[model samples]
Target: MEFTAEIDIMPLDALLDPQGKAVSGSMKNLGLSEITNVRIGKHITLKVKAKDKSEAEAKVDEACKKLLANQIMEKYSFSLKELVA
Candidate 1:
């Protein structure tokens, strides 16, 4: 079976995101004062071939932990869906 994984990786809440802060600050300059505390993160999409949903999920998790995300400063979450057709 083929599965699609949608992953989101973000800096830990305890850590300050400089890029997000910069963008948030710019929002005010653009006359959008209502927008605040903006956070920047990464979204990754990939396809995995596995025998079943459980196996696909495991592969996605492994990829996130071992390659996609820096476990020390960033956290990640992923959802898997079976691809039809």
Candidate 2:
């Protein structure tokens, strides 16, 4: 069977997000000061081949831990959906 994985990776809340902060600062200049504390993150989509949901999840989790995310600075989460075709 095959599945699709949607992954999100973000910096730890305790860590500073320079890109997010920069964007937030610009929001004020753009007359959108109401937006604050904006946090930036990444979204990834990939296909996995596995016999079952659990197996697909395990592969996606491993991919995040081993390649997609930096555990020391970021956290990751993913959801898997079975592919219809």
Q: What are the lDDT figures for the candidates, one per model?
A: 0.95, 0.95
Give per-candidate clash totals: 0, 0
- The lowest-lDDT stretch of 10 consecutive residues in candidate 2 is 76-85
Provide TM-scores for the models. 0.95, 0.95
Residue 5 Cα positional deviation in candidate 2, in Å, after optimal superposition: 0.6
- For model 2, the superposed segments whose C-alpha errors exceed 4 Å read none
lDDT of model 2 at position 50 = 96
Candidate 1 segments whose C-alpha is farther than 4 A from its true place: none
Q: How do the residues 56-77 of candidate 1 rate in per-residue lDDT, one tens digit apiece?
A: 9999999999999999999999
TM-score of model number 2: 0.95
